[model samples]
Target: MRLRHITGSEDFVADSPYVVHRSERYRGVWNRELFPKPQPIHLEIGMGKGQFITQLAVLHPERNYVGIERYDTVLMKALRKRESAEAAGCRLENLRYLSLDARLLPEHFAENEVSKLYLNFSDPWPKARQANRRLTSQVFLDCYTKFLRKDGTLEFKTDNTGLFDYSLESIPAAGWTLLAVSRDLHRDPVLNEGNVMTEYEEKFSARGNPICKLIAAPPK
Candidate 1:
């Protein structure tokens, strides 16, 4: 998918307090002082257009929410959404964005720092050779384990069956225990309740696509 490059997106991000300019500088200090109340940090990796993470931040003001995106153009959209929300009198003090690659997670987060991780409709990287690039691949799972707390849960939702299957296998292979699995997320009334929808999730599910979801935790 071609991203519409927003002119001055980089400049906007640099000026916004919501975007962490030098994320690595904070590192282990994020929880101590970055957010107002030192709440448990919940991260949404590959946050597209900011829908899910932003809504989560609004719904749960007690928790700190961070949305990480690699593309400046995409991150800009997410940042703008926060601005719009604030303009409409929404309090988003606990929300923030990081324009960085997922691979650098360890450099910016301390061990057991993140309380929960969300992977929403990440790139499938379907080709056999590109399998490792999938967010659910062992490469990324290993990276997540380093930052997630002992009982930290990683919740994932995707429309791609191949990627979902791969994640089911990869999680256990990486020594994480699968806590829950749902092939059809919306069908499960228990999981569907209070489930925030991502941009892709709403688009796909409207077309009758069965969304896949799972929750897994690092082994103790």
Candidate 2:
């Protein structure tokens, strides 16, 4: 699949007021000192338009959140939501955004730094050759295993059956133990209540497509 160019509006370097450094030392210093407490460092990869993370930050003030979206054009929307929340005195001190490729994830996070990782409605990348590029591919899961805490869990949701099937197989191969799998997220009212729907999730569900959700935890 061809990659689209990210616009300047969503460029973190160009738009984010927070210090977004890629250096390991810089990340350590910021996480330890700059950010408050840093107890629950949950990561939302590919946060499009910011609706989900914004709601999460608003509702859960105790857990710190890190949103990573590479596409600047799409990322700007999430940033705006954060800015608005802050302005309104929502005081979501636990939220932040990073603009970079997931491949560079290890560079910015220390070992066992992340508690939870959320992959919400990432691109299907429908072609056979693009399978390796899927967010839940073995390569990416391996990266998560390196940075996530031993008992950490990965929550993945998508509307694409093909991608979901591929992930179910790939995650286990990468050494993660699949704990729960669902073909229809909405049918599970308990899951639905806790979930903060993404822009794509709403759109897909509105169109009557069943959302596929799964949770995998690292081996004990």
Candidate 3:
């Protein structure tokens, strides 16, 4: 997706206390350094506008949440949503935002540090030659193995059928196991329960687009 430069976004991200700067310094001790209490760490890659993660942070205060967005222009929007959530009387101290590339996750995190990882509607990189760029591809799955615990899991949601299908094949080929899968998540009452919708998810669902979800366990 082409991003239009948003004026002051870079400044806003730099100045926000919710944004974690020099995050590499806190690698192995993210839970110790970021939150008042040490707890399980849940990370969201490509956390677009922050709606999904902010809600997750509020709903599960026991967990430490980190959201990563590559662009300051995009992260600024998430910061505003986080602020709005706080204004509406939501507690989100356990949540923090990072303006970083997804491919660099291991550089900022230690081995077996993440408890759960979420990938939501990531760019599909549709071209066949660009398959390695998909979050579920072998390259990224290898990257994930470095930081995810033996029992840690990855949850992914997307409206793109091709991407979802690719993930279905890629994850298992990478030696991971699927715990759950739903081709139409909203139609599955069991899965839909406690599901938080991202802005794009809501828009797509409203248009009758099916949302696919999968829970994958890392190889031990």
Candidate 4:
């Protein structure tokens, strides 16, 4: 599902008045007109090219999705895809993007605001000193606890074995209970189905690397 040239000419004003501002950062917010009723909010950090969340938003229209990507170059692709989805009138009223750092999550969302968090093929800072920067680190997980609901879930996938192993050990320390873990996602078709492959995932899986996935929940 790769395109030779994604629409990149249209620039989005991050500070547009319509955008929601919190603690100096901007992100799109869904109004009551879009949902009619309050819906559960789900977030995906580092949503590369928006393939995963875009499909998820279309499939689960009952829930709202927010994708956070720091890089505008890559973020534009996701926006284009979302715009196309919206133009078709295909149930894309629930999706939005945030160009901000993952560390700034607390400022934008209130306590118990997010129901689920997705981390897919995040950067694996393989060095020891850089471990804190990993998205699955205890520090970041602790930050998420501030916004995640009591029964909130964190779904993660990565092709890096080191990161996967590190997460398996860090989740408990961060006060999250590991619910499901898989070293080879392809073996389980049910969960794999409708799972949109990211740019990195498509490349690594093509090389025969088994993708690792896990589901963790905040301890009640």
- The candidate that wins on TM-score is 3
How do the residues 1-220 of candidate 1 rate in per-residue lDDT, one tens digit apiece? Answer: 6778888988877888888878888898897768888999999999989989989999999999999998888888898888889898889989988988899999999998899999999999889999889888889989988899998999999999999999999899989999999999999998888999999999999999999999999878
TM-score of 3: 0.98
Error of 3 at 142 (Å): 0.6
Q: At residue 52, what lDDT does model 2 achieve?
A: 90
Worst 10 residues of 1 by lDDT: 1-10
| Model 2 CA deviation exceeding 4 Å by range | 1-15
Model 2 vs. true fold: TM: 0.91
Candidate 4 versus the native: TM-score? 0.85
TM-score of each: 0.97, 0.91, 0.98, 0.85
What lDDT score is found at residue 175 in candidate 2? 79
lDDT of each: 0.91, 0.82, 0.94, 0.80
Cα-lDDT of candidate 1: 0.91
Model 4 score (lDDT):
0.80
lDDT of 2 by residue, 1-220 (tens): 4656565674455746652655465554446754787577889999888889888888988888888888777777677777787788888777877888898888888778888999999988889999878999987988877778898899999999999999999989887899888899999876666877998999999999999999999755
List, in order, the clash count of every candidate structure.
0, 1, 0, 0
lDDT of 4 at 100: 77
